[model samples]
Target: MDSPNTLAVRIEPMTVDDLPQVLEIERVAFPSPWSARAYEYELRYNDMAHYFVAWLDAWALRHPANDGVIGWLRRWVRPAPTVGAPLMVGYVGYWLMAGEAHVSTIAVRPEHRGHSYGELLLAHTLQDAARHGAHVATLEVRVSNTAAQQLYLKYGFDKVGMRKAYYSDNDEDALIMTTPPLNSGQYQEKLRRLQIALTMQLNTQMGRKLSLVSRTGA
Candidate 1:
């Protein structure tokens, strides 16, 4: 429940228009973040890269009590309208080459952390990657980030190797994590169950339904 924080989120392929908000979260999420140009190249020219963004649905976040008769009356008694586009709460990107997909980056906005939004992004993006033909998935996380390691492990990733001084900002070694062949029956069952659990968890906090959605990369 992440401290009873109600949330509703959508996952979609990152469009060029999402960069502004993406960068806003990126700047504070890492010690040495990728520059705008870097993201631009990935979205615009990198054919192997597939990226997705998670939006916090403003309409979904509105109080459920503001509905039907109560909502209709509230409009006249105390009018408050849900407006504007859903905001980008986080993003995840990965590069797929041959049969391998490498999780490049993932982050959530500071205020939106601890709600499993990062896990949502990771799970959805990884599913997308598999759908697009990723046989295996891999990622590198800071050795000190036990939290991230735990999450990866929960998703069937295991520590396979390491790269010394992987983070330029801190010279911290990175633990290389990789998942089993994504098409394995065991993995399929695991992913299916986890996704179902995630949906139930999300709806529990959302106060409403927020279904998963994705799009093909350009």
Candidate 2:
């Protein structure tokens, strides 16, 4: 059952058209964001890269701003050209190589942070990876990010090793985490249980319910 406030959210392949909003999120989410050129290369040339964007369908019309500068602008631009479409909220990127899926980056908008959106993105990525013939999924996180580490642990990722001074900006160590074979029954069952729990959490905390839909077939 979906909550009344639930929004239609979908994850789709990242296209060049999505870079504008994706860049905005990238700038705010990371201390060292990837350059637009880098993203362009991945989208255009890197066959191994699979990036996705999460969109809140018809979000603008459903929650219109009737007051403030944004409202005034909306009035000024009467008969707004764009309406009734999904607005990109967050993104996830991964590279599939040699039977492994490496999660390069994932982030949600700052204002949209506390709603279990990140978990949703991660779950989608892992499921997508499994469907695409990946045996394992892995990622690296700043050692100091315990909250994120905890979330990864909850998703069946384990700290297998550490990288020395992996972060360029602060020269911080990164914790290397990897999941067991995603195609295995054990891992799939674990993911299924987590997905069920996540659905409950998002429904309760965000006033909105959502579900995962895999493009490549999960």
Writing each residue's lDDT as its tens digit, candidate 1 over 1-218 gives 21224454668888778898898889989888888899999889999999999887556435565568967886676444356457787999999988999999999977567768899888887788888889999999999999999999999999999999999998999999999989888998999899888778767766556555655455
Worst 10 residues of 1 by lDDT: 1-10
In model 1, the runs with Cα more than 4 Å from the true position are 1-8, 60-82
The per-model lDDT (C-alpha) reads 0.81, 0.82
The reply for model 2, stretches above 4 Å from the true place, is 1-5, 59-85, 209-214
For every model shown, what is its TM-score relative to the native structure? Answer: 0.84, 0.84
Which prediction has the highest lDDT against the true structure? 2
> Candidate 1 overall Cα lDDT vs. reference?
0.81
